[model samples]
Target: NRLLLDLETDLFATCCYVDVDMEEGSAWYVRAGHLPPVLRHPDGRTEVPESEPGPPLGVIRQTDFPMSPLRLQPGTILALTTDGLVESVEVDIEDGLNRLAAGLAGSDPSHLGLVADELLTEANRSDDVALLLMRFDGMDVLPSRESWTVWRVPEAVRHARRYTRRALRSWGVADHTDAALLIVSELVTNALVHTDGQVRLDLTLIHRRLRIAVADNSPRTPIKPTNIGWEATGGRGILLVEAMSDTWGTVPVSGGKQVWSELSLD
Candidate 1:
């Protein structure tokens, strides 16, 4: 709102702004008398956001532009361009837009820089041609990440360790692999060994701290069984976790319990 007021009074120009909410992987944007941006999702989905546009900036002293919101999933692509790119004496803007969308669809999603260059090739010389391409790397997906996967008993044990190790290494927390692999293996093992229903492992990494969490549909909390003698098999995993990890704990969650541990990167 404050931004809209400023745009109305401060300057005379056609522009757009996207304010991204990192946690939600969504954006709030205002298109004040500018061409709408083209959005392409990883699934080959393409769209142009629809919102009522206010007059160009400075057209009215106290203008109010409605800000629209949209999801920005990981691997999503956004292409913003000036009107000059589509406006040509020889071509209709509609034709230009169709061409642009087709070009974006055909271009390699992995190499969007090259796609942008190819787009500029079709630009008109009658006015300024400007383009900006953005690809989203959502915090919950990659760069900073999280994952949910079910575990089924003995088979899941190996998979859980492998997944945790690979995910940590992908996060560039190689130092954590030795400790995290052991910790996650323990947690996943406990979840499967004791639980009856669904078992899941959720992994998250943030700011050099790696959190390994396992949730399972068991009402019971983890504890060393008195009858199981402390040997190679008796609750040694938890003991190893306590000694090797920076911190560890358990909490009650809906229909189950969640055990989590945090490892320090530095």
Candidate 2:
């Protein structure tokens, strides 16, 4: 069970505790005035369920805190964090959650610490951040098409875009071809801007959408521009990606990071 409490008074503080059941991987958790945790599957799916929480502890006595049970299946990832880690006064919560979900899907659990760090660094706004990531093992890997290819430099972006187009078509998502191509270009450009390392692009067609991910040996993740004015001209790359992409985010890897974007066929 994971318990988290957030106090918003003069003394801003966050508290968390974890209790695991030996009989099963399921846990009984509770939240109090804190953001709910998100769950991710090994196959790159993620979500944040509504958490029925009580009033913040210390703010109210005799509060009835409801306990939520979460069963961890093999390859299931459970992530909990405070608003300080992901909240943006200007960005919508739904967009933030979508990006967070994508990041978890592409993140490597072996580097969970780095993953949390990257998330906070990208979205920090002068508040303390805390995160908890728990993953289950022994799950079956989803079956995917064995088709793949490699490219170098400028060719990588164009080649990957073509491959994405084909993959999306195979998934009956031909309409998303253009969006996938643009997303691939943006991610590849970001990679090139930061490093000259070998960039690997992976395009996965699932359901009716195309999942475009670019992996590079760079640690930095994209951030929305803060210096907004009539003459603001730079720092809109991520904004465009977010506005155009169905969803997108970044996952920290062993030596680099994988930034991903999703586009729907319809």
Candidate 3:
């Protein structure tokens, strides 16, 4: 609706959204009259995944945009760009796409900026251009696992804080120890207090973020408290987590709901 409103205001816009599945080695994409995504394989072969483009936004009303599938192989680099990156009034869109592919095909995948620079040079860029690159590293490595605990009520909160501290240390993210431990404590406390069964605390450390999840047996959701009172005991727990966490949310799984929070490493 918001996009349609922008189009109604006479702002011509086109976009391409791609959701990559690293594990499955595929991506589901939507091309809204923008350039189709290009996949550069390991063997220096670049190809654009077939996609039907819709009319540019603001040109048509009540348009239906279709999704397309893009399969990714190991060591493949996916390039998504706005038309300016590959198209101009003077150059044919297909030729521009070929130029982008050729530029990326021979370039090293690690340094993506060079590929973009080369493509821009070939394009003789006159308009604004936005380029996004994704290189899918092979999924051959073993997954990492961490220890977690299950407990009920107040006991778990203390245990969670201690466990969180140790986990942060082991992950070499000791800098976030204080804040992350505090955030984990609050989330675990909420799970224990609200649900019946034992609260399961899970922590996973990714490349960019540290994720902490507290799962309980009850389906009830944790409310984000607006009014916080550090002095007045209780009820400001979720608010504290929200303040400390980079991002937080609740997910309802098979047995119950899990309240999770993430803290960025950088």
lDDT of each: 0.79, 0.69, 0.78
Q: Candidate 3: deviation at residue 45, Å?
A: 1.4
| Number of clashes found in candidate 1 | 0
Ten-residue stretch with the least lDDT total in model 2 = 1-10
Model 2 lDDT per residue over 1-266, tens place? 12222333444233333455533667677776666778887677787877688766566545677787777767788887766666677666667777777788888766778877766666666766667787767424332342443456567667767776777666666765666677777777777766767777777654555677778788887777866676776566677788888888899977788888877665
Residue 133 in model 3: shift from native, Å?
A: 2.0
Q: Give the residue spans of candidate 1 off by over 4 A.
A: 1-11, 140-205, 209-266
Candidate 3 lDDT over 156-183, as tens digits, reads 6777788778877877889878888888
The top-ranked prediction according to TM-score is 3
Greater TM-score among 2 and 3 belongs to: 3
- The TM-score values for the models, in the order shown, are 0.50, 0.44, 0.63
Output candidate 1 Cα RMSD.
Answer: 14.5
Determine the backbone clash count of candidate 2: 1
Q: In candidate 3, which residue ranges exceed 4 Å CA deviation? A: 6-8, 58-61, 140-210, 213-235, 242-260, 263-266
Candidate 2 collision pairs: 1-19
